[model samples]
Target: GSLEHTAVLALVLAMALTAAAPALCFAALAVAAGGLGTAVFCPGERRSGAAVFTAGCALGALAAPNLTGVLTLGLAAGAGLLGFLLCPEQALRAVFPPPATPVGTQSLTSAARKLSGVADTLSDIAETVNAVCSCQMPPRGESYDYVVEFCAQHLCQNCARRNTCWVQGYSTAMDGLYALRGALEHNGRVELEDLPGQLSTCVHPADLCATVSHGYRLWCSRRQTRARAELLRTALTEQYSAMATALAQMAARLGRAGLPDPRREARTTQLFASLGLEPLECTVLTDLAGRVTAAVTLPRTSFTPGECRALAEEMGRICRRDFDPPEVTNCRTVTMLHFGERPLYRAVFGLASRPAPPETVSGDACRQFCDSAGRAQMLLCDGMGTGKPAAVDGQMAAKLTAQLLQAGFAAESAARLVNVALGLKNAGQESGATLDLLTLDLYTGRAGLFKAGAAPSFLCRAGVVRTLDGASLPMGVLPTVTGRSTALTLDVGDTVMMVSDGALCDGSAWLCDQLTLSTRLGQSPQQTAEAVAASAVRRSGARQDDITVAIVRLERQKS
Candidate 1:
């Protein structure tokens, strides 16, 4: 290949040597070096004699009749010959190294100015707000005459030692309230007639409610209980009535402040003034009815929102507050929703699993997640078919649902996210799964149900079984989905049972009968769960698919 390449170069070189072009002279020099190499390296190679080559070039040059051209060509050829004789890199570096490019002044200045502009803009925004986050924080509170550093530890409303006192005081008060409620429940019923007789033993109203037992102070029998119960009830009633009234008035004021009247802003301003804190343009969703939600705001001073929330909760111990915990936001703004008198509930859960006829991995997936907030979410996902492939779909749906719920998504929202994720996943796998989710508020014993093409779930409360039918297409079956999302009470000792469709191969009535029988037998929740699953398996017999059952029993937390 190089030999053919050399021949083409040699032909062009010969033509160039006959003219006075610089490129031709360079070509001639390159051809001459190749000839010399061939003559020296290979003796058998036939080469054009130097005398003949020189004569031909001379004749062509004379015919051109251009003395200046002849001189230029001779000089060019000499230079090219020298280049071939020398190292290429050294020669090129010395004669034709590229020039360094200079940076443009205009572009450099513009870039610096642009960066500076952005920095200045950010600085301005920071100046406008008290504290800034990735998402915009509301602007700082306006200047206040009474409270000079209105948002922080230096508030005029609170004395310097107020916080220290408040923290310990609130905790003690809350503890007292919890003790009182526990006492009242333990007593069962109270009478109002023997107030003087009940007060004889207990020194004060606080002592009456908080004291669980006494060498005779805690009324043991109904005969001894009523008189003291009546007195304790009367005392508590007299004490808390004023607190309740204050809470109601405060709630009414908050509601009115949200109205369109011109006095609304003035009222809010005055209210915050009384509280000794500067008023924000908007109180995060708002605080009302004895429950206060401190929207995620930077504590301007040493005072923090959590502390304020704790104070509010302590105040609410006297009266019920409606606290609806805030949903999670993208800005990661921690919002606290409060509901008075709803302490997190405690629950016990049990689950059972049985694989399809011959598959190693069951096509059913069950999961339960409980967060520190006493929020619990349970999921039961059944893939369309049995085996590992179907099992993967079920697991994916269940995992997504559980994770989303833990991340503070409500049942409906988490289900929607799972539905979309399943839809996206379906592009690669044609399988779809039924999602049955239960989110329970341990505080209120309230459970929310979200289902997509799921089987009927059962709730056994006070020995009565209620079936919740979930009518919808399986996840990933439709672009726009429709499913059941409902909330209902799951009081103490109530059991919520969920199962895969395979468990109900025949009808729901059989399972209900089994549940009722188990309830009547006074079986524990774990035993009940096992019995329910066992019954379904026995009913399926030779035609079993994938059987799974999960039961959650709500119970009041022990003191």
Candidate 2:
């Protein structure tokens, strides 16, 4: 718009000048040029094209003669006006076509630049390939200096553009030639007609043969390396998957074994020993034992009665064991002293038997039996590391703790026993296990909590959560010392949660918020867990450490 206006004004002034003074032909020419130039070069109104045009015009006008005289001034003004009025719209349109409609101008420009770079690079590669091919000497050692000289001459001719294309092109051509030569050398000479299709297409067979021969050497050299790495990765993945499956199975088995004190290693050792296995075979057999132990013990701390029962049922199925159905034989009104409330810690029991129940039952079975036998002892342990070793550690901790707790040993003494076992097993090594032992007197609901390097337990009362920070070094790390047990009392509707570090690090606050939002929208736990897991995996950006969580809710006993 500005350019158009300027053109119009210039034409008007030029016409006025011509009308005022017949002698000012130069002024008319200058004004016409200014207007035409402005109309041609000036961009859209938003641009400074019009201002540029005006400045050029003013400078031209200043150099014109007779600017002070009335006649000359009148002529100049008239010429300027005439030039502005006479400037053709058609001429302006020719100078500036309608702006091209583009999806994205910046993107198009970037794409163009990329393509241009690729094209330049390819051209250089082509030149290099041609040079190498042309310089190939025959097997008889015929001189190929002429071909090399020719390539050198071309390189000199295009020296400025050489770096961009020549180096890359030369490298690619050399690679191709090397691959061809290596293939030929390894596979032996093929008839010109019987050569591979790729080789046949090469303009220089000698160079291609040399490349193929070189490639064959490289392939042969690294074949074992590539194969070994792949085999190792596959083995590792299989081991991981097998361990996970075993853990799941073991957890179910422990749940069904309604024994008063189920010992993980005892069961594993017995299982292996029954099969005539050596001591080293114990490692493989017990690979998933600890995980199972941890999973079984998890319910005591983190599961509701209903959930516990459900888990027990699942365990029975996996372990192919039968447990006495959970029965509420008598309603005993019991007040939990910890939170000073009356809650039902129902006495429940079921039996889980494999082909043969190990001499000792798992801690989970013991806890289940305790609930039924009117015993108040719960032991929790998390194995260090992951898979086999960690699972083993956890199993040992739970087994030892459960054994001592059932024997009427105090919680502190039981924890000390477990810690001693862990330290012995992992002597001189940094590896250690953590245990959360709780010996609850079902009759009074008096709890003796022994935390061994486990995260502080949480107590939920009246919808508010409080952490019980009974911090202690995990077992296996150090010798058992005094001052470990944290005695407390529980009340009705007070939920106690104990979990492995895996569970605590499962998801972030943002992820929890998202899960909460999904829950508010009525997403099921299965769905929530799936989403949480997926989101956690995504957020983690890599395979994370193991994850586990357990929640135990205590409710008033049903009369």
Candidate 3:
């Protein structure tokens, strides 16, 4: 309370009322002030602001004060303090409150515009490149000119009968030469008797046929190369167009502002004020999914865990929605609180790996983490063979996959990108690896399994075990990668088991049995994974390979 400011306000009122019956005016003012204080200080009360103001006016008209004015003011102040302490809400509302205005959109619009412009530029470039690439396609097949050109440059160059075949009898020589194309294309070579009369009478007919055959093969190889290059160009153009479209969509989403609730904001503010912390700003934003997020900025203060939980519960009740615990960020002068919607489920992961016999390093790698959207990802990569070289490939694939997924890349897209990276890592030598990816959406309890030349995985629901397998080539084997994906809804206590091919050298029957047993016994994910890996190695005997096993279990999140 500003005591000096209050005194100044009272003096100003007294001076203004001195010319119009000062004593009676002062008495009415005193009663009006007391009733107004009582109404203003009582937070969370349902009385209309106009009703409170009218009641104050009525009390002023009926009451008169003289020497008892001091006692009346003291009692009013005490009652106001008591009401402030007792009321859970601490907001102060005027009789005519201003309209509620939205936040964040004004500041976000500029950034969204810039991003949209960049996306448009990219889209335009992609369209232009795609149009150009589509227009300039490589020739479909081997051309007739290649054989003639090859024969003229290589065979007829140093022949003694070059003049007879070129200048004097150019037309006859061209017909005889063109006739060899059919023979060479059909049989991959031309015999002496297959040539026309003009070419049959050459100084060396056998040599000419051989030369034509070689030239045709060369022309076919060049055509194939050009076709491959064209295909690559088309693929790149499509990728650019897709990237531009994704960016544009992202910008549009960012530009779309979520609705703000003024009632929720006021309640949140008052809640903080009741906790002895006056919020500098309070905003409640709701997304298209109907999830509410309340952001409150308050003067810097220490918040304990219990207080945060209680505050979150209170806020949830105030907004009539369930919210996760608040994420707190403190600055020098203020603390920011953000409360989002809680997920429906939680997934736990466990992994176990072992190197091959006589090897110290394992060729299999794995990574498990939750993405920004709360989707849990499990990546298991197995390289071609055991040892350091294989370890490098496995690690690279797993790392790249994790990073791409975390950066919002789709599962298939991330796997394709990792394949291209591995293929380009080494120039001449061939390298390949199997990639197994499992993604679980905690909010929806949907699980997706993506495999690239990986071994079959087992899904254990209740007491039954089901095998998930797909036919695909390993990454780095070709310029393009092939993969298979499956989606299924998961429930509480459902477990997913994944293993490398090396672990199933004997067969998948044992692995399936192991998964079933683990599920029946209700073992922890870690224990189940370790048991699977150990059983696999024991079954392999002396011819052991690099073994890796990963497990995921879904459970309902505790309230």
Candidate 4:
């Protein structure tokens, strides 16, 4: 058979198949290219794997669209084939893939499991965060089962400064455990430097005491222990005056009883009793689609399982206040999904912006994140201008970036993923957004800020403000990007503020002054956001750009 004649006939056939099955046609063309390359590169070698990979890439290109996507896929297919011819192992590795950047644990298995284990529970954080639902009770009798496990857990135990030192201890312990396990299992595949620095999360005021308090509250209700719990509660409050003081001292001084110390349990019992707060453990989850599926574990109530079903439904609504989902369902049992209040912190966001025409939507968008590992992230995007066109660019940047972060991707990886996605989305069109991302460790009040062509963000701690400015160009405008990232420390009563150019028109110095004043005045995060937006609007006198301000405060909780 003459290959030239066959190539011509195959091209004609592919052209015909494009109308009925474009994806298949693409696959065939990619296979043809890869097969030819393999045959020429390594005459006696088998390259079936490379051919399959090429076909898969072609199918992926169909889903990705754009000339950039198709070209990238074509190049990859060619490279895969060539690589298979030269080194089959490397080619196979590319198709099979390996574990992503490790989280610093020792066991390859544990780290891998941490990355891909609990497949049904959470495959991607971005998808899960989006699924944060405000699901009202579904039609009664409709039910779904979720196997939830606490993917990560940390406890700063036995600390004179439990609240203060516990965070670091937990971080060290988790990191070391992983490092040791990884050494034993993966033989140097995982790196501690690659592991996440720490764990963080946010909890409600009622859940302040969490595990310790829940046990105490339950213990107090018994008629025999009511008098003792009440006395203990009063005494515990006397030890700490304010919530801030309580948080610090509790971390430093609190301990539960075990061995020789008979008073250990009693000590916790009294402390939790004084808090007068209830404990409800809930975490955000995602279904197959990127919708929020909040997993909650109800405490043991005297009510029977049948009776608790209705009660659980009612309580479910209250738990989902942070996530706005359309419907909520319940598993009519004492379900214990993996959840803990480690490294707790509360996150809040606010925006104030006007469109260029005042008819179209503003260009800036803010995304609040509850990523895996109890981490909270605030991602802000501002497009080129203040109109619908700008809004689209900004929304894409914010959303895609957020999803990547939620999916357990690091900031750098997330940025790259967003870049590729945007490059494919707006091939010939010019679209871009200034993205500002800040991740706060709830446990330690440490913040990491990453920027891509964004304005400066502020950090307000103890009434003192610090400014962090951006250092990169906007995303979507570039084929590849690695924005600036820096670590900043926060202590008790710290607030991180982000604003668009419109908000800064009043001047960064002036904005800093205002934030410091707000902190001194003890303004809440929402109130501060409103005040900042109001000031920006006042400065513009109604003629303004799309201005957005986000405030995230780390509060030390009191029992």
Top TM-score prediction, candidate number: 3
Worst 10-residue lDDT window, candidate 3 = 90-99
Q: Write the per-residue lDDT of candidate 4 for residues 153-216, one digit (tens) a residue.
A: 2222332445543354655534433433333234322233333333223222222224323332
Ranking by TM-score: 3, 4, 1, 2
- Native-vs-model 3 lDDT? 0.72
Off by over 4 Å in 3: 1-90, 93-262, 265-289, 293-339
lDDT of 3 by residue, 324-421 (tens): 66766565676767666667888889999989978999999999887535588998999888899899888878876776665555677667666655
Candidate 1, residue 95: how far the Cα is off, in Å? 86
Q: For all candidates, what are the clash counts?
A: 6, 76, 0, 40
- The clash tally of candidate 1 reads 6
Q: What does candidate 4 score on TM?
A: 0.43
Q: Which stretches of candidate 4 lie over 4 Å from their true place?
A: 1-336, 348-353, 541-543
Cα lDDT, all candidates:
0.55, 0.44, 0.72, 0.53
Task: Give the distance in Å from residue 98's predicted Cα in candidate 1 to where it truly belongs.
Answer: 68
C-alpha lDDT (0 to 100) for residue 225 of candidate 4: 45
- For model 3, what is the error of residue 430's alpha carbon versus the real structure, in angstroms, after optimal superposition? 1.9
- Tens-place lDDT digits, model 2, residues 1-559: 3344656777887788778886654566666665566556754432344455455556556655765644564454556556744677545434443222222221222223223333443344335334532443112111123323333343334455445334656655334333444334446533354444433334445543344444344444455455434433543454345334434543453344222212332233343234343112111111122212111100112235684365345434534443323322111221110001112364221111111122132121113225322444544566666556666666656665554443334455445544544543553357767776555555456666677677665554554556666666776675543336676786654445544454445433454355345435554433544454455444443434444333344444563
Query: Mind giving the per-residue lDDT tens digits that candidate 1 earns over 157-210?
Result: 354534543354545433433333333444642223222332333224433323
Q: Cα RMSDs of all predictions?
A: 31.5, 36.3, 11.2, 34.1
Off by more than 4 A, model 2: 1-344, 347-373, 481-483, 506-543
